[model samples]
Target chain A: MVEPLRHVTPFWPAFWRGFRALMPLWLGIIPFAVAYAVTARAAGLGVGETQLMSLTVFAGASQFAAAGLFAGGASAWGIVATTFLLNARHVLYGLSLARQVPLTRPERVLAAQFLTDEAYGVTVVHGAREPGGLSFGFLLGAELSLYAVWNAATFAGALAGAVLPDPAALGVGVVFPLAFLGLLVPLLVDRKAVIVALASGLGAWGLSRVLPGGLVVLLAGVGGALLGAVLVTRRGEA
Target chain B: MSVPLVTLLMWLVTYPARLLGLSLGRLKLPPFWLAFLRFVPVSVFAALIVPDVLGSPEWPRRLVGCAVGVGLMWRTRNLALGILGGFGAYWLARLAGL
Candidate 1:
């Protein structure tokens, strides 16, 4: 087991690579964060409330889902239920990181705070490519930068909502999906992946008609995973 | 609790779950669950994106945007470029009265 803090290169190359890896994704975060703030505030949250949600929950999709329900005049319990349902996916992240990194209790606490979708994906991809300890530096850079930008965007959006003309006309809400789609596009490599993507997509659409809140997301994801795994396994047998 | 208090409360509450998972790392997690864990990001993301691409009510325009986005992302492996293609296609179709 490598010590977690062994590599200490105080140099330009590491900084440059880390910056390159993170900046594009971080740049796109501004619109999404701003949208979240505006929408959350619009949904009756004060500026402080909006910032609080982002700072703590930091789960973009769940927050948005919560805000949408809030805006629709859903009960507070309804809002909580929706957010909980949407963020149920984080449980998977907790499990994966647990096996890979034998963290102390304190480290696990920090890991949960830092493990957003982008951060986790980047961390896992780098971990696969190189030793885990060395990759922590890169992961930290990405995660910290995201933390700063996301909070900053939340603040800005809240401020803007207090002053600016309507953001809806510009389709500010759409930016969230656009940003996600950007991330999603890079990962669809193989036939199985494509099939899973399509299946999940269709499943979510069909299920959402009957299911309330974020159950559709959960159902589609589970369905896709089962389908993809079965297809991959059958292919291996052949 | 107030908003900031709620924020702090959530952070504090989730802390235990994180720590528990970490400390229990030594215990063997179920293999099938771990395997499923590997694909959660992509799978969850797809569940979110597909519905958007298909555009809730405007089917034709949304389909076009989704196609363009998926195609560009496939060819360039540039996420930004793919997003631009999809978003631009949507706007263009809207502008052309589609």
Candidate 2:
């Protein structure tokens, strides 16, 4: 069955609004791509393999996990398994977005390729303010802008990684954590958020040593959320 | 199997996850579940960043980068400035032969 557009907004306004909405995200996105490509390169992936992964794979956490696991001498099957498990959340994201966005089949197929945590967040928030729940043009703009920046940044990093005598000598590796930190810092607004962040950060730091790469993320995310819940209920809201 | 096929395999693993979810008829998640998910991004980012910044063998350099990044982010609330400062600080530290 074909779904109709939810609202009557003009295409250009919605599209440009979607494009403009993600401008703040480019900071995290750019450094993120650079960090991943350089990491993949330092892990001994060929420039072609590194660029291809960003072009096709496009999931940050999985790409990072694969690079780290590859560096640790993981088998190909193991890496692919990790990729699937890490990406399982995208399933939830799509379900949520589809109900909100009203995408037709072809659009859903195209949209699925660019779906990620940031894309989902921006679109949902932007959609909420629209007269209807969502707009196709807005989503198109957001997804395409993000897709363009992410790939361009990734390819630049790959080329830079290939040419740099030592990516380490230039501190390329620091971009990963710092880039992530840049995104996370603004969100630490309350005790609950702070607790969740600390708990997850410490949990990840500890769990990473014992568990496989993907498991650390899952367990830490749950642990942090659970801790935040407990803290929220234990005390009155500020 | 050829090794360069790994990225293709990664695509195979990921694409269907989203496609399948989108195919599901309009579904409404429970309220509590939605509330809980509000914390996912912060937790996930922290979880991902901590191990990378602190657990890596290159912690000292990453720590410097993060310190600068956080300091600038705190002062400016500007994502671009904070990230660029972090990169510059890291580069300077490395250039100084740290």
* Residue A56 displacement in candidate 2 (angstroms): 2.2
The 10-residue segment of model 2 chain B with minimum total lDDT is B25-34
For candidate 2, what is the recovered fraction of reference interface contacts?
A: 0.66
Report clashes for each candidate as comma-separated counts: 0, 0
Model 1 C-alpha lDDT per residue in residues A30-98, reported as the tens digit of each score: 777887888888888898889888878787777776677667876655565666676665665566566
Tens-digit lDDT string for candidate 2 (A125-223): 567577655777788788777888988988898889766455455555676676667667877888779889998999999999998656787788767
DockQ of each: 0.46, 0.53
Give the runs in model 1 whose Cα sits over 4 Å from its true position.
A1-20, A98-104, A125-134, A172-174, A234-238, B1-31
Docking class of 2: medium
RMSD of each: 3.8, 4.3
What does DockQ come to for candidate 1? 0.46
**lDDT per residue (tens digit) for residues B10-97 in model 2:** 9999999878777773655554444455666677778878998888887877788789999999899776678789888877776676
Whole-model lDDT per candidate: 0.65, 0.77
